[model samples]
Target: MERAVRWDRLREEMAREGVELLALVPGANLFYLTGLHFHRMERPIVALLPREGEPALILPAFEVEKAQRAPIPWRLFPYTDAEGPASAFHAAAAALGGRGHTIAVETLGMRVLEWSLLAEAFESPTPLPAEPLLARLRMVKGPEEIAAIRRAIAAAEAALQQWLPEVRPGMTEREATRRLIQACFAAGADALAFEPIVVAGPNAALPHATPSERPMGPGEMMIVDFGVIMDGYVSDLTRTFVLGEPDPETARIYEVVREANAAGRAAVRPGIPAEAVDRAARAVIEAAGYGPYFPHRTGHGLGLEIHEPPYLVQGDRTLLTPGMVFTVEPGIYLPGRGGVRIEDVVVVTETGGESLTTFPRELRSL
Candidate 1:
């Protein structure tokens, strides 16, 4: 990633908004800026990007060496565990002229501890939400980010295909989850994007169900929502399956969801609102008399984070633009029976949308 170019865009937005500095915690935004992945722990780490100067960081003493290896230069303030983080925060604040300046922070990512420390050190400066500015910059992905997402999709699909053969009628969901993790690593994944949602039958009705000790049975619907990380990018894909031939009702649900997924993808263009996709897909489901069964937004932006801006739901009027990538997933869940969801990662092109995920959408028996 070209850190300087991204930083320049951020700085420009800061100036326009009267934001003197940007405070970041360790996560997608931090990694996007510094290419460093420090774990968010009790020690509290914050990287500050000023409107006009080199960046500064308040990190542990042991992490200074790693921060130095970052793509861009930094003014580091290292603190030891015994000394605590207060003094280092104060020093960095003074050096960056942060006192009494309007600062931007990630409302979604910053913890209370980190915010409190900054408040004390900077004498309670006005804090503003940095989400809009960051979203504007990160929503439209670049060439390298696109490539990394493709690689992540490839690895995740390959692992799923390899793990499919091992899924049996009597296999426990937890046991199956273990096998899926092994398959993901074998398929060259840097990490699992999130815990694989492997649930069968009634369990599948819940969108984010956790794997349990309950056994999967033949002819039961299985929802496999999984993703993997490759080159720091993520791929989220969901494909519902059946251990045996699906019942007529189950099959119809799957078909409705598949058509909705297609409509959502086809609705994409360079000059339309993001919610158009949701309306197109939702119309299909509602027409089939399954409107209330389908819950959640039609999709979400995909890149550095599994969920981001340009959400495919009503009230989001952000115009679709080239280089923007997001998911197009539509699902229907029956309270006591099962659920059907087909998701694919899609990219906005000069003319229309192109699916980055190539996994087959056709319902197949495991």
Candidate 2:
């Protein structure tokens, strides 16, 4: 029932919003609507869905085989190199009645060259932003999507745990990252979501730092931030640990961040505003007198992409919904000393938010 309901709801939303048609390029939104993942090449590809009719796919002749796998019912408009890629796009626009009617498009995903051809296809060329409609449809997680995310988290967690024993002193950051990624493949992950962050000592102070040749030292704080992809969905997480015995000050900061992370997760409930959840974690760090060191927002949404709407930050008025899933990460960075960041994937429920990744957050000294 949920499987059928997922696609049906999107069509209903398009009709209700008075969107005559929707044009999606190669990106998360495209994959979200139709389960098709293809490359954007010289010959472009687009999925066109009408409010009350079947979808049409326009692509180069080479893309027809892959586009056929799209979940949505579609008509193919394939063109060859002689006619150019935009030729196929023009053919699709002709089917949609010269684009005088309102057409919804994803601004971020569509390329400039495609936009130019599209703009020329229309007489008035008024493009409506499709993010609101797309976001509305994707905000709630269906049973299948939830299952994929859970599986992704499990594989990612296993990858991190498998590398724990090898995180001893004298290990290069890049070497440790390689082993961690190998564990992900061994745990059945199809691909990694992003380049994993492997930072030790002062390098840990910079969030999103790349893995380097720096060797692990005794008592140095290390951060391993990584994610895995499963069934087109993504899972993101970060854990900080010490190589040897961390100083008392480092331990205190770790505890503060852990407490802040907990506070953020606890604040997620059905009527609370997104900003309030961020404040909940921010308050904890502020109370501990480390507010200045705690930079960046508490967290962001996770699903088709690493980042999305309903962000956990100050002044985000978006209210929590039961099916919404995001991360609750809190960090404290003291320049020249080190930093700690702990993150987990969580889904908002009727009772409260349920954390998907439950790796222990206790400060660990390897």
The collision pairs in model 1 are none
Per-model lDDT: 0.93, 0.85
The most accurate candidate by lDDT is 1
lDDT of 1 by residue, 1-366 (tens): 487799889888888888888999999999987799999999999998989988889999999999988777789999999999999999999998857978899999899999999999999989999999899889999999999999999999999999999998899999998999999999999998888998998998998889999999999999999999999999999999999889998999999999999999999999999999999999999999999998899999988889999899998999999999999999999887778889999999999999999999999999
TM-score for each model: 0.98, 0.95
- Backbone clashes in candidate 1 total 0
lDDT (10s digit) by residue, model 2, range 1-366: 543565687788778878888888888887776767778776667777777666778787877888776555678889888888676777777877775767788887888777777777655566788888888778778778888999999999988888798778989999999999999999999999999998899889998788899998999999999999999899999999998898999988999999999999988898788888899999999999999988899988889988887889988888889988899999999898789999989999999999999898998887
Off by over 4 Å in 1: none
